[model samples]
Target: MENSKMLSPEQLYEKKIHVIGRITILMGIGLSLLVPILLWIYYGVFPPMDNLLKGVFTVSSFMIPLSIAEILSFYPILGSGGIYMAYTTGNIANLKLPSAAIGMEVADVKPSTKEGEIISTIAMSGSVIMCELILVVGVFLLGPISVKLNSPMLKPAFQHILPALFGSIGAYYILKDWKLSVIPMIIGILFSAFNVPTSVAVPICVLCSIYAAKFLYKRGRISL
Candidate 1:
Protein backbone atom coordinates (compact mmCIF):
# COMPACT_ATOMS: atom_id res chain seq x y z
CA MET A 1 0.00 0.00 0.00
CA GLU A 2 1.18 3.49 -0.87
CA ASN A 3 1.61 5.79 2.09
CA SER A 4 -0.62 8.83 1.58
CA LYS A 5 1.75 11.04 3.57
CA MET A 6 4.72 10.14 1.36
CA LEU A 7 3.09 11.38 -1.83
CA SER A 8 4.81 14.29 -3.55
CA PRO A 9 3.10 17.65 -3.65
CA GLU A 10 1.95 17.12 -7.21
CA GLN A 11 0.44 13.72 -6.45
CA LEU A 12 -1.25 15.01 -3.33
CA TYR A 13 -2.68 17.90 -5.30
CA GLU A 14 -3.99 15.56 -7.95
CA LYS A 15 -5.64 13.33 -5.36
CA LYS A 16 -7.27 16.28 -3.66
CA ILE A 17 -8.51 17.52 -7.03
CA HIS A 18 -10.04 14.16 -7.75
CA VAL A 19 -11.75 14.00 -4.38
CA ILE A 20 -13.04 17.54 -4.73
CA GLY A 21 -14.38 16.83 -8.18
CA ARG A 22 -16.26 13.79 -7.01
CA ILE A 23 -17.63 15.67 -4.01
CA THR A 24 -18.86 18.49 -6.19
CA ILE A 25 -20.53 16.16 -8.64
CA LEU A 26 -22.25 14.18 -5.92
CA MET A 27 -23.43 17.31 -4.15
CA GLY A 28 -24.95 18.57 -7.37
CA ILE A 29 -26.72 15.32 -8.07
CA GLY A 30 -27.90 15.04 -4.49
CA LEU A 31 -29.32 18.52 -4.46
CA SER A 32 -31.05 18.02 -7.78
CA LEU A 33 -32.88 14.95 -6.60
CA LEU A 34 -33.43 16.13 -3.04
CA VAL A 35 -36.90 17.63 -3.36
CA PRO A 36 -38.73 15.01 -5.31
CA ILE A 37 -37.10 12.26 -3.33
CA LEU A 38 -38.12 13.85 -0.04
CA LEU A 39 -41.64 14.37 -1.32
CA TRP A 40 -41.91 10.75 -2.33
CA ILE A 41 -40.66 9.73 1.09
CA TYR A 42 -43.06 12.10 2.80
CA TYR A 43 -46.07 10.63 1.01
CA GLY A 44 -44.87 7.08 1.60
CA VAL A 45 -44.49 7.65 5.31
CA PHE A 46 -47.50 9.85 5.93
CA PRO A 47 -50.08 9.03 3.32
CA PRO A 48 -52.77 11.07 5.08
CA MET A 49 -50.64 14.17 5.48
CA ASP A 50 -52.67 16.17 2.96
CA ASN A 51 -50.55 19.28 3.31
CA LEU A 52 -48.02 18.30 0.65
CA LEU A 53 -46.38 21.68 0.16
CA LYS A 54 -45.86 22.22 3.88
CA GLY A 55 -44.43 18.78 4.35
CA VAL A 56 -42.09 19.19 1.39
CA PHE A 57 -40.78 22.47 2.74
CA THR A 58 -40.35 21.10 6.23
CA VAL A 59 -38.45 18.02 5.09
CA SER A 60 -36.22 19.96 2.69
CA SER A 61 -35.19 22.42 5.37
CA PHE A 62 -33.85 19.60 7.50
CA MET A 63 -32.43 17.43 4.73
CA ILE A 64 -30.47 20.05 2.77
CA PRO A 65 -28.28 21.22 5.61
CA LEU A 66 -27.78 17.70 6.84
CA SER A 67 -26.77 16.62 3.36
CA ILE A 68 -24.28 19.46 2.96
CA ALA A 69 -22.67 18.88 6.34
CA GLU A 70 -22.44 15.15 5.67
CA ILE A 71 -20.77 15.65 2.31
CA LEU A 72 -18.27 18.18 3.60
CA SER A 73 -17.34 16.67 6.93
CA PHE A 74 -18.11 12.94 7.05
CA TYR A 75 -15.44 11.79 4.60
CA PRO A 76 -12.62 13.61 6.41
CA ILE A 77 -13.66 12.14 9.73
CA LEU A 78 -15.03 8.69 8.91
CA GLY A 79 -12.96 8.03 5.77
CA SER A 80 -14.11 7.60 2.18
CA GLY A 81 -17.79 6.63 1.90
CA GLY A 82 -18.09 6.20 5.65
CA ILE A 83 -19.76 9.50 6.46
CA TYR A 84 -22.41 9.04 3.79
CA MET A 85 -23.62 5.79 5.26
CA ALA A 86 -23.28 6.97 8.86
CA TYR A 87 -25.14 10.18 8.18
CA THR A 88 -27.86 8.36 6.27
CA THR A 89 -28.35 6.09 9.24
CA GLY A 90 -28.23 8.97 11.78
CA ASN A 91 -25.57 7.33 13.92
CA ILE A 92 -25.75 3.80 15.25
CA ALA A 93 -27.20 3.09 18.70
CA ASN A 94 -24.24 2.39 20.96
CA LEU A 95 -21.31 2.83 18.59
CA LYS A 96 -20.60 6.50 18.62
CA LEU A 97 -18.64 8.15 15.81
CA PRO A 98 -15.04 8.50 16.84
CA SER A 99 -13.97 12.05 17.62
CA ALA A 100 -10.70 11.83 15.75
CA ALA A 101 -11.67 9.10 13.35
CA ILE A 102 -10.04 9.44 9.97
CA GLY A 103 -12.56 7.38 8.00
CA MET A 104 -11.17 3.89 7.27
CA GLU A 105 -7.72 3.67 8.82
CA VAL A 106 -6.56 1.51 5.90
CA ALA A 107 -7.42 4.08 3.24
CA ASP A 108 -4.30 6.07 4.05
CA VAL A 109 -2.21 3.22 2.73
CA LYS A 110 -1.12 4.12 -0.75
CA PRO A 111 -2.20 1.93 -3.63
CA SER A 112 0.55 2.23 -6.23
CA THR A 113 -0.40 -0.84 -8.24
CA LYS A 114 -3.36 -3.00 -9.22
CA GLU A 115 -2.51 -5.42 -6.42
CA GLY A 116 -2.30 -2.57 -3.96
CA GLU A 117 -5.66 -1.18 -5.06
CA ILE A 118 -7.27 -4.60 -4.72
CA ILE A 119 -5.83 -5.04 -1.25
CA SER A 120 -6.89 -1.57 -0.21
CA THR A 121 -10.36 -2.19 -1.57
CA ILE A 122 -10.62 -5.41 0.38
CA ALA A 123 -9.47 -3.72 3.56
CA MET A 124 -12.01 -0.96 3.06
CA SER A 125 -14.71 -3.53 2.43
CA GLY A 126 -13.90 -5.12 5.78
CA SER A 127 -13.99 -1.82 7.64
CA VAL A 128 -17.34 -0.95 6.15
CA ILE A 129 -18.74 -4.37 6.95
CA MET A 130 -17.62 -4.09 10.54
CA CYS A 131 -19.27 -0.73 10.96
CA GLU A 132 -22.43 -1.93 9.25
CA LEU A 133 -22.74 -5.02 11.41
CA ILE A 134 -22.58 -2.87 14.49
CA LEU A 135 -25.27 -0.67 13.01
CA VAL A 136 -27.57 -3.59 12.08
CA VAL A 137 -27.42 -4.93 15.59
CA GLY A 138 -27.99 -1.48 16.99
CA VAL A 139 -31.04 -0.96 14.80
CA PHE A 140 -32.45 -4.37 15.59
CA LEU A 141 -32.34 -3.56 19.27
CA LEU A 142 -33.49 0.00 18.84
CA GLY A 143 -36.53 -1.00 16.80
CA PRO A 144 -38.29 -2.53 19.78
CA ILE A 145 -37.16 0.20 22.13
CA SER A 146 -38.50 2.87 19.80
CA VAL A 147 -41.80 1.02 19.68
CA LYS A 148 -41.99 0.80 23.44
CA LEU A 149 -41.11 4.48 23.69
CA ASN A 150 -43.77 5.37 21.12
CA SER A 151 -41.24 7.20 18.96
CA PRO A 152 -42.92 6.77 15.60
CA MET A 153 -40.38 9.00 13.83
CA LEU A 154 -37.44 6.92 14.93
CA LYS A 155 -38.99 3.70 13.67
CA PRO A 156 -39.47 4.72 10.06
CA ALA A 157 -36.08 6.40 9.67
CA PHE A 158 -34.25 3.50 11.27
CA GLN A 159 -35.82 1.04 8.86
CA HIS A 160 -33.68 2.54 6.10
CA ILE A 161 -30.44 1.60 7.85
CA LEU A 162 -30.13 -1.94 6.53
CA PRO A 163 -31.01 -1.24 2.93
CA ALA A 164 -28.62 1.71 2.75
CA LEU A 165 -25.85 -0.42 4.21
CA PHE A 166 -26.39 -3.29 1.77
CA GLY A 167 -26.96 -0.92 -1.12
CA SER A 168 -23.49 0.54 -0.59
CA ILE A 169 -21.95 -2.92 -0.76
CA GLY A 170 -23.95 -3.81 -3.85
CA ALA A 171 -23.00 -0.57 -5.57
CA TYR A 172 -19.31 -1.08 -4.85
CA TYR A 173 -19.19 -4.63 -6.23
CA ILE A 174 -21.36 -3.76 -9.20
CA LEU A 175 -19.00 -0.95 -10.09
CA LYS A 176 -16.00 -3.25 -9.74
CA ASP A 177 -17.26 -6.08 -11.95
CA TRP A 178 -20.71 -5.39 -13.32
CA LYS A 179 -20.84 -8.38 -15.63
CA LEU A 180 -19.83 -10.89 -12.99
CA SER A 181 -21.31 -9.13 -9.96
CA VAL A 182 -24.73 -8.44 -11.43
CA ILE A 183 -25.70 -12.05 -12.01
CA PRO A 184 -26.08 -12.65 -8.28
CA MET A 185 -27.92 -9.40 -7.68
CA ILE A 186 -30.24 -10.14 -10.57
CA ILE A 187 -30.99 -13.60 -9.26
CA GLY A 188 -31.50 -12.19 -5.79
CA ILE A 189 -33.98 -9.63 -7.05
CA LEU A 190 -35.87 -12.19 -9.12
CA PHE A 191 -36.10 -14.56 -6.20
CA SER A 192 -37.19 -11.72 -3.97
CA ALA A 193 -39.93 -10.86 -6.48
CA PHE A 194 -41.37 -14.33 -6.03
CA ASN A 195 -41.76 -13.65 -2.28
CA VAL A 196 -39.00 -16.02 -1.36
CA PRO A 197 -37.93 -15.89 2.27
CA THR A 198 -35.10 -13.38 2.66
CA SER A 199 -33.04 -15.69 4.87
CA VAL A 200 -33.00 -18.35 2.15
CA ALA A 201 -32.99 -16.23 -1.00
CA VAL A 202 -30.35 -13.67 -0.01
CA PRO A 203 -27.58 -16.12 0.89
CA ILE A 204 -28.28 -18.45 -2.00
CA CYS A 205 -28.24 -15.65 -4.52
CA VAL A 206 -25.05 -14.12 -3.10
CA LEU A 207 -23.19 -17.42 -2.86
CA CYS A 208 -24.32 -18.50 -6.29
CA SER A 209 -23.14 -15.24 -7.77
CA ILE A 210 -19.76 -15.47 -6.01
CA TYR A 211 -19.05 -19.06 -7.04
CA ALA A 212 -20.26 -18.38 -10.54
CA ALA A 213 -17.85 -15.46 -10.79
CA LYS A 214 -15.02 -17.63 -9.55
CA PHE A 215 -15.86 -20.33 -12.08
CA LEU A 216 -15.97 -17.85 -14.93
CA TYR A 217 -12.61 -16.39 -13.95
CA LYS A 218 -10.98 -19.79 -13.63
CA ARG A 219 -12.23 -20.74 -17.11
CA GLY A 220 -10.86 -17.42 -18.45
CA ARG A 221 -14.34 -16.26 -19.37
CA ILE A 222 -13.88 -12.91 -17.68
CA SER A 223 -10.91 -10.86 -16.48
CA LEU A 224 -10.96 -8.36 -13.61
Candidate 2:
Protein backbone atom coordinates (compact mmCIF):
# COMPACT_ATOMS: atom_id res chain seq x y z
CA MET A 1 0.00 0.00 0.00
CA GLU A 2 2.83 2.41 0.87
CA ASN A 3 4.62 1.55 -2.38
CA SER A 4 1.45 2.27 -4.31
CA LYS A 5 1.11 5.68 -2.61
CA MET A 6 4.76 6.53 -3.32
CA LEU A 7 4.36 5.48 -6.92
CA SER A 8 1.42 7.89 -7.34
CA PRO A 9 3.41 10.81 -6.02
CA GLU A 10 6.40 9.95 -8.23
CA GLN A 11 4.17 9.74 -11.28
CA LEU A 12 2.59 13.06 -10.48
CA TYR A 13 5.98 14.71 -10.15
CA GLU A 14 7.08 13.28 -13.46
CA LYS A 15 3.92 14.54 -15.13
CA LYS A 16 4.47 18.03 -13.80
CA ILE A 17 8.08 18.02 -14.98
CA HIS A 18 7.05 16.87 -18.41
CA VAL A 19 4.50 19.63 -18.70
CA ILE A 20 7.07 22.22 -17.72
CA GLY A 21 9.50 20.89 -20.28
CA ARG A 22 6.87 21.10 -23.02
CA ILE A 23 5.98 24.64 -22.03
CA THR A 24 9.60 25.70 -22.19
CA ILE A 25 10.09 24.16 -25.59
CA LEU A 26 6.97 25.83 -26.91
CA MET A 27 8.03 29.21 -25.55
CA GLY A 28 11.44 28.92 -27.16
CA ILE A 29 9.85 27.99 -30.47
CA GLY A 30 7.47 30.94 -30.27
CA LEU A 31 10.22 33.43 -29.55
CA SER A 32 12.40 31.97 -32.27
CA LEU A 33 9.64 32.68 -34.75
CA LEU A 34 8.41 35.99 -33.39
CA VAL A 35 11.60 37.96 -32.78
CA PRO A 36 12.93 37.55 -36.29
CA ILE A 37 9.60 38.62 -37.67
CA LEU A 38 9.62 41.79 -35.61
CA LEU A 39 13.18 42.62 -36.63
CA TRP A 40 12.38 42.08 -40.26
CA ILE A 41 9.39 44.38 -40.06
CA TYR A 42 11.39 47.10 -38.35
CA TYR A 43 14.14 46.89 -40.94
CA GLY A 44 11.66 46.88 -43.75
CA VAL A 45 10.12 50.12 -42.53
CA PHE A 46 13.29 51.96 -41.49
CA PRO A 47 15.72 50.71 -44.13
CA PRO A 48 19.08 51.71 -42.74
CA MET A 49 21.60 49.88 -44.89
CA ASP A 50 24.75 51.41 -43.44
CA ASN A 51 23.70 50.82 -39.86
CA LEU A 52 22.23 47.45 -40.73
CA LEU A 53 25.53 46.04 -41.92
CA LYS A 54 27.36 47.42 -38.91
CA GLY A 55 24.74 46.02 -36.56
CA VAL A 56 24.98 42.60 -38.14
CA PHE A 57 28.73 42.61 -37.71
CA THR A 58 28.49 43.78 -34.12
CA VAL A 59 25.96 41.10 -33.32
CA SER A 60 28.09 38.45 -35.00
CA SER A 61 31.21 39.62 -33.23
CA PHE A 62 29.57 39.35 -29.81
CA MET A 63 27.59 36.17 -30.44
CA ILE A 64 29.77 34.01 -28.20
CA PRO A 65 29.69 36.28 -25.14
CA LEU A 66 26.02 37.15 -25.50
CA SER A 67 25.14 33.50 -25.91
CA ILE A 68 26.80 32.80 -22.57
CA ALA A 69 24.74 35.51 -20.93
CA GLU A 70 21.54 34.11 -22.44
CA ILE A 71 22.38 30.61 -21.17
CA LEU A 72 22.82 32.03 -17.69
CA SER A 73 19.36 33.63 -17.95
CA PHE A 74 17.82 30.15 -17.88
CA TYR A 75 15.60 31.10 -20.79
CA PRO A 76 15.78 29.38 -24.18
CA ILE A 77 19.04 27.56 -24.84
CA LEU A 78 19.30 29.38 -28.19
CA GLY A 79 21.31 32.60 -28.20
CA SER A 80 18.77 34.65 -30.13
CA GLY A 81 18.57 37.47 -27.60
CA GLY A 82 22.22 38.24 -28.09
CA ILE A 83 21.80 38.25 -31.83
CA TYR A 84 18.72 40.45 -31.64
CA MET A 85 20.48 42.84 -29.31
CA ALA A 86 23.42 43.09 -31.67
CA TYR A 87 21.20 43.67 -34.68
CA THR A 88 19.04 46.35 -33.06
CA THR A 89 21.83 48.34 -31.47
CA GLY A 90 24.05 48.08 -34.48
CA ASN A 91 21.39 49.53 -36.80
CA ILE A 92 19.43 52.18 -34.93
CA ALA A 93 21.12 55.52 -34.57
CA ASN A 94 19.79 56.46 -31.12
CA LEU A 95 16.93 54.16 -30.19
CA LYS A 96 18.77 51.43 -28.33
CA LEU A 97 16.82 51.85 -25.09
CA PRO A 98 13.46 51.67 -26.79
CA SER A 99 14.63 48.85 -29.03
CA ALA A 100 15.78 46.83 -26.04
CA ALA A 101 12.44 47.38 -24.35
CA ILE A 102 10.67 46.12 -27.45
CA GLY A 103 13.04 43.17 -27.60
CA MET A 104 12.12 42.20 -24.02
CA GLU A 105 8.47 42.16 -25.03
CA VAL A 106 9.16 39.84 -27.96
CA ALA A 107 11.47 37.62 -25.91
CA ASP A 108 9.27 37.33 -22.83
CA VAL A 109 8.61 33.79 -21.67
CA LYS A 110 5.50 32.59 -19.87
CA PRO A 111 5.80 31.98 -16.11
CA SER A 112 8.33 34.79 -16.12
CA THR A 113 7.57 36.81 -13.01
CA LYS A 114 7.60 40.56 -12.88
CA GLU A 115 11.10 40.41 -11.46
CA GLY A 116 12.36 38.23 -14.30
CA GLU A 117 10.82 40.54 -16.87
CA ILE A 118 12.45 43.52 -15.24
CA ILE A 119 15.79 41.79 -15.18
CA SER A 120 15.57 40.93 -18.88
CA THR A 121 14.61 44.51 -19.65
CA ILE A 122 17.50 45.92 -17.66
CA ALA A 123 20.03 43.50 -19.10
CA MET A 124 19.01 44.33 -22.66
CA SER A 125 19.04 48.02 -21.87
CA GLY A 126 22.55 47.85 -20.51
CA SER A 127 23.71 45.96 -23.56
CA VAL A 128 22.24 48.65 -25.79
CA ILE A 129 23.92 51.47 -23.93
CA MET A 130 27.34 49.88 -24.17
CA CYS A 131 26.97 48.79 -27.76
CA GLU A 132 25.64 52.18 -28.89
CA LEU A 133 28.60 53.97 -27.37
CA ILE A 134 31.03 51.71 -29.15
CA LEU A 135 29.19 52.05 -32.44
CA VAL A 136 29.12 55.85 -32.24
CA VAL A 137 32.78 56.11 -31.46
CA GLY A 138 33.74 53.68 -34.17
CA VAL A 139 31.69 55.48 -36.79
CA PHE A 140 32.94 58.92 -35.83
CA LEU A 141 36.61 57.98 -35.70
CA LEU A 142 36.63 55.34 -38.42
CA GLY A 143 34.09 56.69 -40.89
CA PRO A 144 36.05 59.79 -41.83
CA ILE A 145 39.33 57.90 -42.01
CA SER A 146 37.87 55.39 -44.47
CA VAL A 147 36.24 58.11 -46.59
CA LYS A 148 39.48 60.09 -46.70
CA LEU A 149 41.36 56.99 -47.77
CA ASN A 150 38.91 56.55 -50.71
CA SER A 151 38.09 53.04 -49.54
CA PRO A 152 34.99 52.51 -51.70
CA MET A 153 35.70 48.85 -51.24
CA LEU A 154 34.77 49.01 -47.54
CA LYS A 155 31.01 49.28 -48.19
CA PRO A 156 30.71 46.15 -50.29
CA ALA A 157 33.20 44.37 -48.07
CA PHE A 158 31.01 44.95 -44.98
CA GLN A 159 27.86 44.25 -46.97
CA HIS A 160 29.11 40.77 -47.77
CA ILE A 161 30.43 40.37 -44.24
CA LEU A 162 27.03 40.92 -42.59
CA PRO A 163 25.23 38.27 -44.67
CA ALA A 164 28.05 35.79 -44.08
CA LEU A 165 27.95 36.41 -40.33
CA PHE A 166 24.16 36.00 -40.08
CA GLY A 167 24.24 32.96 -42.35
CA SER A 168 26.80 31.27 -40.11
CA ILE A 169 24.60 31.78 -37.04
CA GLY A 170 21.63 30.35 -38.93
CA ALA A 171 23.69 27.41 -40.19
CA TYR A 172 24.43 26.35 -36.63
CA TYR A 173 20.79 25.36 -36.12
CA ILE A 174 20.04 24.29 -39.70
CA LEU A 175 22.67 21.58 -39.51
CA LYS A 176 21.00 20.18 -36.41
CA ASP A 177 17.72 19.25 -38.07
CA TRP A 178 18.33 19.56 -41.76
CA LYS A 179 15.25 17.59 -42.72
CA LEU A 180 12.89 19.74 -40.68
CA SER A 181 14.84 22.92 -41.47
CA VAL A 182 14.24 22.78 -45.19
CA ILE A 183 10.48 22.96 -44.83
CA PRO A 184 10.49 26.28 -42.99
CA MET A 185 13.23 27.82 -45.14
CA ILE A 186 11.37 27.06 -48.32
CA ILE A 187 8.09 28.35 -46.96
CA GLY A 188 9.70 31.51 -45.64
CA ILE A 189 11.36 32.16 -48.98
CA LEU A 190 8.14 31.70 -50.88
CA PHE A 191 6.24 33.90 -48.44
CA SER A 192 8.87 36.62 -48.68
CA ALA A 193 8.78 36.46 -52.44
CA PHE A 194 5.11 37.39 -52.29
CA ASN A 195 6.11 40.61 -50.44
CA VAL A 196 4.27 39.53 -47.35
CA PRO A 197 5.17 41.52 -44.28
CA THR A 198 7.98 39.92 -42.32
CA SER A 199 5.95 39.98 -39.10
CA VAL A 200 3.25 37.84 -40.66
CA ALA A 201 5.37 35.71 -42.94
CA VAL A 202 7.70 34.50 -40.22
CA PRO A 203 5.06 33.12 -37.88
CA ILE A 204 3.01 31.70 -40.72
CA CYS A 205 6.01 29.89 -42.15
CA VAL A 206 7.05 28.61 -38.73
CA LEU A 207 3.59 27.26 -37.96
CA CYS A 208 3.38 25.63 -41.34
CA SER A 209 6.77 24.02 -40.92
CA ILE A 210 6.01 22.81 -37.41
CA TYR A 211 2.71 21.25 -38.40
CA ALA A 212 4.23 19.71 -41.51
CA ALA A 213 7.12 18.28 -39.54
CA LYS A 214 4.74 16.77 -37.01
CA PHE A 215 2.64 15.29 -39.77
CA LEU A 216 5.66 13.79 -41.50
CA TYR A 217 7.09 12.46 -38.27
CA LYS A 218 3.86 10.75 -37.30
CA ARG A 219 3.64 9.19 -40.76
CA GLY A 220 7.19 7.84 -40.33
CA ARG A 221 8.43 9.87 -43.29
CA ILE A 222 10.94 11.78 -41.18
CA SER A 223 12.92 10.92 -38.06
CA LEU A 224 12.65 14.34 -36.42
- Estimated TM-score per prediction? 0.34, 0.38
Taking every candidate in turn, the Cα RMSD to the unseen true structure, in Å, is 19.1, 15.7
Residue lDDT tens for model 1, 64-152: 65455445433433443333334443442123233112222334432233333334334444555777898799988986676565677
lDDT of 2: 0.56
TM-score of 2: 0.38
Once superposed on the true structure, which residue ranges of model 2 sit more than 4 Å away at CA?
A: 1-144, 148-150, 216-224
* lDDT scores in order: 0.56, 0.56
Clashing pairs in 2: none
Worst 10 residues of 2 by lDDT: 74-83
Error of 2 at 65 (Å): 29
